[model samples]
Target: MIKKLAIDDLRPGMEVVQMSSSLWEHLPNLYTQPGPIKSEAHLKLMREQGYQHAFVEVEVPGEPLEKRLDAILADRMKDAPIKERVPFDKEIEVADRAYKSAMNHAHRLINDAKMGRKVDFEGTVETVDGIVNSAVRNPDTLLCLSKLAQYDDYTYGHCINVSAIAVVFGEFLGLSRDELTRLGVAGMMHDLGKTAVPERIINKRARLSSAEFEEIKRHPQYGYDILKRQGDVPEDVLEAVRDHHEKFNGKGYPANRHRSDTSALARIISLADVYDALTSDRSYKDAILPNKALAIMYGMRDQAFDPLEVQLFIKCLGIFPSGSLVKLSTGFYGVVYESNPNLPLMPKIKIILDQDLRPIPSELVDLAARQAVGDENLEILECADPTDYRINLKPYLTRTR
Candidate 1:
């Protein structure tokens, strides 16, 4: 059987069946195929490359590896603090309203920009205000709802998602209310330049030729131009739209401005922008799981993004962010319901399957709780793909609190 094993428990005899996720694209030299563990040196190299777990073939097991991992997790979670969460139903209600409002505003803004009409700055502020309120009330709700990536328009959905994410991250950073509003506006309008690009180029399913790629890269400047013409837009908002694609190491596009040249708002929006794009399903490629996206972003720290900002982003989202599908130590499948930043690894989960892999009535589980019914030793074994099990998480996730 394919079992998920922690890096520390790996032995030379075991065969690696799969990587925890397809992150090798970011680290080209990292080995990703199924292979026999060569030596402790190999394990060391994998750890150095940021791999924490892998799926391996196990033949000589005393107890199931899942149970063993769960026991370890439960032990570690004994002292984890249990914080009360916003009721799921209430959060879903708020998220639904915010998402619809953002989507409507994004569609209008994009269409208006395409027609050379000035964007409604007051309308943008009002939309962002609602997003900021939802984020400050309970960031996880909108964040979790954002994971429902079955949208008709990628651009609109992406802008809304990025805006919600930026607001949450801004709040986490202790930005003033005014600052959060600006960050939200920046995120909502960061991709406005894409509207100026040809529809064919924007939705192309294949790699772009050099000339086409260059045209695509002009989006930051294009977005800046569009927003700047509005006249009343904030300077910080314009800078954020223009510099969101710039890298911290001076390697990013357009002006190639580096580090201190980029404003703090732009840096924050940049992380959110890339993160939402990576996790959202697109016409060209499948979306990576949230945990995997975070890992890839972590690997890109100091290269594509600011290291401290990346770390803070991960901290803000927690280890297993909302919408992650995980297999519990008790041999059940569940969706991450909420994250406890203080106890990231032990966030609350909503159990959907029982140990036998049979469908069961959903139940909320808090891994940080001192005592859980039926399975006191419950713990997450590893992340699982909802597609693999043909599970539809939308109903469960969007249900009323």
Candidate 2:
């Protein structure tokens, strides 16, 4: 008989069988090789493959594994109450308020540009400056900004993404707080010229005709003019906004030159803009996966992006960004809610469904430590698309009052 060991008792010599809702597997980790299982399916697949010595985690009442997982959760909750373990409610409230405020401000700023009436462009800059300054001082604010993507409009969404990316990029590049705020301003304003474009062209759902494209291309110039007219905006800010699209490969429009000619802020903004745009759904295509987008950026290194900057961007955003949906080997899907900064890829996931894609009572899985404990048998099959899963996370993550 295989000896049963508590997860904490798992060490580098014990053998056990692991099972979950959709999987069963055998692993040496329970006794010999110690590590958390990487995914849900590994347990089941290993079991099917004839491995007998494995330990698996399941929620079934009365099962030894279920009891183990429950004991672990109970112990964890006892040590750090559920309120502290996952403060999703409080965080969501803060995020919702910030997003709404930023959306209103962004929409007004864009509308102001559409009307050709100079609203306080400087004020928009000031707001970005304030946000960046706060984020630099308190990293948690960065988490709040990530939630801004929940808003739908491109203008507001892009602004929030830009601001967040700029702050992160600034941190990566070791820029001072003052410089970070300025870089963020440049990012937020990089597409300011879009406001001058005709709404039909701006909001066109289809590919632009050449004439329309050419007209659209003029927005950079339009943005530069707008900034120049705005009293006393820094020259660097104007340059970054106007030149972000101009690539080093001379392939980008408006002025195709090597990225070496671009200002540092422009270089940083260029990478951020492309990453956000690629990860976001556009008129032409649905949003691509962030990892896939990062791979594409790697392909464009040196030609379209600064190679170092691209690497840094990946480092900053991690293998899986927050808010992404992922799949476990068990075939269940979950949304990534929080990631420990040190381990950007593995985060605390709130699983809403089980393998085979059936809704279940929800639970949080801390992929980093839970799987690694005694289940090398577990593994991630692949990333799942949350949009396809019909996951409405707001209700679970948010508190109305």
Candidate 3:
């Protein structure tokens, strides 16, 4: 039933199989592989953009798209042997500097947007590139810094962290250096549309009313429009801003798009954005521990995120993600210092409290080397909240070994 039809003949509910058949030569990336036209709004966008016609699949439905999406996810989730080229202890200092520079750049992007100054959409190249280099060398160092440095400036902090987390995850996915850098830039710019929202709404400490919620949902489109006007923003970055909240089930905001309509980078950033938001402190709610956050996200798989993406994200960050505190099966308390990607459960731990649960000088121990060292085998029994133990992890995470 696939047939070429003039754009006027197409209507809501028709499935656009492909643009390659005719017209749509310069369509946006998201429209390249159009799905069911969900609304008149979608048709409006298509018609306004001069889409002359589309190859629509009429009446006949099949499982091919679903099977294709599964295959794409399978290819992406292949594990790469990502080694720490530079030791965490040695790279922490360098990562700290890069983290700071990126934070400053995030602030600059916001300030320029608010002040009506011309933003250098291309300027993010160097800022995110710095993070890409550090994360590739030792991913844990940047991740550790992101967790420990939860600043009062939650918006900017969030932007930089999402970028950093995305870079770390991109590296684990074995993306090329260029792709990682662009993903970083996308993360940094993902929330730029919030600048158009009122400060009161963005920082409100209470639940947003239904009216306010609707306004907030406009942020993705707002961000996309803002960047589109800037003229040089990459398509990947624009897609991330506009589609990061989109769910696999087509219930998410801005476009109600499913996984098939979204770019892979947007899907990846969506995971990073939610992970950081779940684990980082915000004015509206206390932050959940990393392990608990991962568990919650894992529970939401298929409903909100891709199941394979969640599984691999957990593998990349580890069960006991870096910079989170945990209690060992040995009855001692420690901070997870770095993830062993191959062995997710057995990470490098730094014991900060004695078995008695009393404060002690920190000792670094590799869980993977337990048998060789002749020490008692240890496993993380549970994740502990930092508030519960009154621990500040910054000093422990940054100290050079």
Candidate 4:
């Protein structure tokens, strides 16, 4: 049987396949070079090398891939039909409040850093903890808030979104709450050094002069310095705060640490920071479609991000992420309000545009359920930028209890 085996769980004789997800179980037999794990020594070597998990053909019998996640994450995965897992509607209100609070805190911290006021690392604990709890309860709700809730200031909003994304991705990776908290804090503070950079260069719409760009490159060190002055923060969080910009290829700034040298939390935050930055609307550019951003990141793997981490991140968020405007096979336009991580290609999109691509009343369609019922005609044809259609996903994302 094909199974998703964590590095620690890999035993001798299991053939490792390069498939996605720790949402693992029995998947299709994909022979990505048919390398069965050799022995206990090899497994130890793999773990020592920082391998997370592997898709492998093993002797153990297991549930099908699609069936396993629903059972394991019944209380955690987005929209798993389990009653104990609070519905997204009930959870989203609390999530929205948490997001706003985190943004407000981010704004204050960044401004304090600018004014040379000492940062109270303790101040961030509550907000980060709230986000982690929500992620543990309903990751999709926290992610939707990240997707839809935009603060007036980009700097603050970006910080909070990165934090939220990191928490959700960390949960998918099976990180403990304490580990997620540190990762979330790292994501929130990663760009605090940008506060030191002159506002003109940071917000410039035109190409930056080489000297100006060099100054921009120093933000990592500047961030490290700012956080170092304020003691009591965890060392790992501080390291991630400084190294989130480091490239997987050892080409990134400050320390220029190789991918293997970087902490896992930093790597997780790096993926979140880049994805949020790419998909976000900025003074420098318009937001790219989620699909486009994912495609770009996929190509940059090993060069920009850890190759396996990138693949897993893409798997967790899905090809068409929540809040994405998408098109269906029936010639309708919709916003993806929720993603199915196990089957990322399918999501529950709220249809709001008709066959003629004109505005229509909202109608939510769960593509997975439709497909499960053999409704082959209903499927996502493509993902699009919501800005292109002037579609506001907020209204469609809410549902009456």
State the C-alpha lDDT per candidate: 0.78, 0.62, 0.80, 0.76
How many pairs of residues collide in each model? 2, 36, 0, 0
Query: Pick by lDDT: which candidate is best?
Result: 3
When sorted by TM-score, best at the front, the candidate numbers are 3, 4, 1, 2
Candidate of highest TM-score:
3
Per-residue accuracy of model 2 over 127-166 as CA lDDT, tens digit each: 5655554454433335435532476776778876777677
Compared with the true structure, what per-residue lDDT tens digits does model 3 show for residues 1-401?
34446778888998876332222444442244568988899889988886767656555244432344556457646654556488888888888898888888788899987776656554566678789889888999878888998575988899999999988987877676666767888899999889899888887878899999999999999899898887556666788789999998999989999988987678888999999999987766889999899999999999899888888888889888899898998898988898887777778989988776787887898988884587656888888888776778878878844
Model 4 clashing residue pairs (backbone): none
Structure candidate 1, residue pairs in collision: 89-400, 89-401
Instruction: Answer with 2 or 3, whichever has the higher TM-score.
Output: 3
* lDDT tens readout by residue for model 4, 165-263: 999988886665567777888888899999899989998888999999999998987888888876556577788888888999999977788887877
TM-score of each: 0.76, 0.69, 0.79, 0.77
Q: Model 2 misses residue 107 by how many Å? A: 1.1
Which regions of candidate 4 are displaced past 4 Å? 1-84, 357-361
- The true-versus-predicted C-alpha distance at residue 389 of model 2, in Å, is 1.9
In model 2, where do residues sit more than 4 Å from their true spots? Answer: 1-92, 137-148, 340-344, 356-362, 371-374, 399-401
Candidate 4 residue 10 C-alpha distance from true site, Å: 38
Worst 10-residue lDDT window for candidate 4 reads: 21-30
